[model samples]
Target: MLPASASQLLNPTDVGREFLRLLPIALFVIVFGIAFGLASVQAGLTDWQAILMSVTVFAGASQFATLELWGQHVSLLPLVAVVFAINARHILMGAALYPMLRELPAGRRYGILFLLTDANWAVASQDYQNGRQNLSVILGGGLVLWLAWVAGTVFGVTFGGLVANPEQYGLDMVLGCFLLSMVLGGKRSPRVLLIWTVAGLSAVAAYWWLPPHTHVIVGALAGGVLGYCWKERRHGG
Candidate 1:
């Protein structure tokens, strides 16, 4: 009683390929998540609470941003808005699938979106556009990232602070470096670069001018809109 796509998610080749391809990034994400967990502890979160958030939310920057705002005594409404806004990128990422998955049933398309993340989106988007990817591949790879992030957070929360001179590992910059490298690679077009620059600047500005978390929402919306608009203009759609 499973759909074709759901059955595809269990394909061994897809899972194996993703497992091999993600090995390097897996370790990196783990270390990065650990750093976040450690940060959560120092920010006054209990050990179990930090790990739980990582497992349940599985969003690092958003989690950190929310915690930072909370530490400053920001109201819960704004905090929720900010995190939701930050997560809006997933919508844009899922939109990238329209061209590739237009023929799939609605439920399957939504299922894919539910598992998408910035990292998996980057990898799977490329594969999808290239006409070589399937639901199996995306799901296989996404599960890896999900597990890596969760394990990493738990590892860091449990033992990171105890490590003497954790700075020596330089794990703090993992996510930034990952995004920077990805953006630099994919920002090949002038329009893409313009949107990226605008979004980055807008987020920073929002941080300073708007209410708490507004910047995150604003940046995501601006970037997504710019990308969509640019694509429309270029494609005459």
Candidate 2:
């Protein structure tokens, strides 16, 4: 009951290409997740909680933020709001990736968007641009990130007591290092630096001016607006 064109569209080679492309990002995420798990556990999250969050949510930033907010004794509504706002970027991410997913089955597209994150988006974007929009690649990449996140969190929770001054030892700084290394190793672009700088400043400003998760929305909107405005102007729109 499958259309000939549809079957032809979903090529096996595309899956292989996606696998190759996601390998580096997968490694980075594994390492980063382990560090994050260690930080979270030392910060007071139990082993099961950290592991569960990793396996279920698989979002390191939101997970860390939740731990931070929980430590401050913030109420549930505010906590949820912050998590939602911080994750709002995924809406835009899903939109950007929608075109590629359209080439696949509806359920597949939905699943991909639901589980996709910054790291997965980066890999998928590259493949899409390269004309290798393979669904299998996306699945493989997402799985790697998910597993790394869970495994790292479990390891951290188990070994947290052994690590001393984790925050001071720069375990907390691994996210920055991971991102920085990714950029430095890639093409140097002024626009990229501009977006990053704007986003960082906005995050700081939001932290100062807004309530818990409000800053997350504000920072994201501020950075996104800055990036969009610049792109529009560049295109003479």
Candidate 3:
């Protein structure tokens, strides 16, 4: 919970300041977006299609995963499930920000959420923990990141054909490496570790035994259920 004195104001000045602060990080995001654009092309999407996906979805990890099954004769149910499982973390993220969001009008609240990404969320979460409120990052920082992603996609789409063999250059492994980095970089409390362990094992089992593409659903549900049932203990009263 935020401190009672924490401000919920969402003024233009603060929004502009946060936008500039996040610009540096958005540069890195552009690189990742470039990678995704190349991969999307290789997976059979046109330049405009890839760009539109990035614009509408705005979820990098899920977009990359979608590329994995793009050319295959995959079921829509499983495809949708996989995307949902990958992006489900947004639900919890939104819940965490509900306190600050509640103070805003519905239009502003949902508008800010439309631009929410991991980087901006981290900025806001860290500030909240330090007894500060920073919703500006959610709106302004998010806009910059979105633009960076779109810009990177444009570059990749234009030059992606140069890299004829993404596999030869190990570009094929980028998604796996990126997801692993996220896991390793995140908080590793015991509860989180346990949930991840269960999720990992479930995914492996589903891969070996269940129908193709079901591992993601199995793993996500396993982890989500465990996290819900085994609540974390609060440290102080």
Candidate topping TM-score = 1
Q: How do the residues 118-199 of candidate 1 rate in per-residue lDDT, one tens digit apiece?
A: 6766766666544455555456667777788888788888887654344587766665677666566542677776887889
Provide the TM-score for each candidate, comma-separated: 0.72, 0.68, 0.70
- Sorted by lDDT (best first), the order is 3, 1, 2
The parts of candidate 1 lying over 4 Å away from their true place are 1-10, 69-74, 101-107, 129-137, 162-169, 184-237
- Per-residue lDDT of model 3, residues 1-237, tens digit only: 534332446888988999998897787677777878898988899999999999999998889888878775767986798788677767767877888888887888898999987778877876765667789999999999999889878878888655445567665564465446546665678888889999999999988999655676688779989977886787532
Candidate 2: list runs displaced more than 4 Å: 1-17, 39-44, 71-74, 127-137, 161-237
Task: Score residue 156 of candidate 3 by CA lDDT.
Answer: 82
Q: What is candidate 2's local distance difference test score?
A: 0.66
- Which ten residues in a row are the worst by lDDT in model 1? 1-10
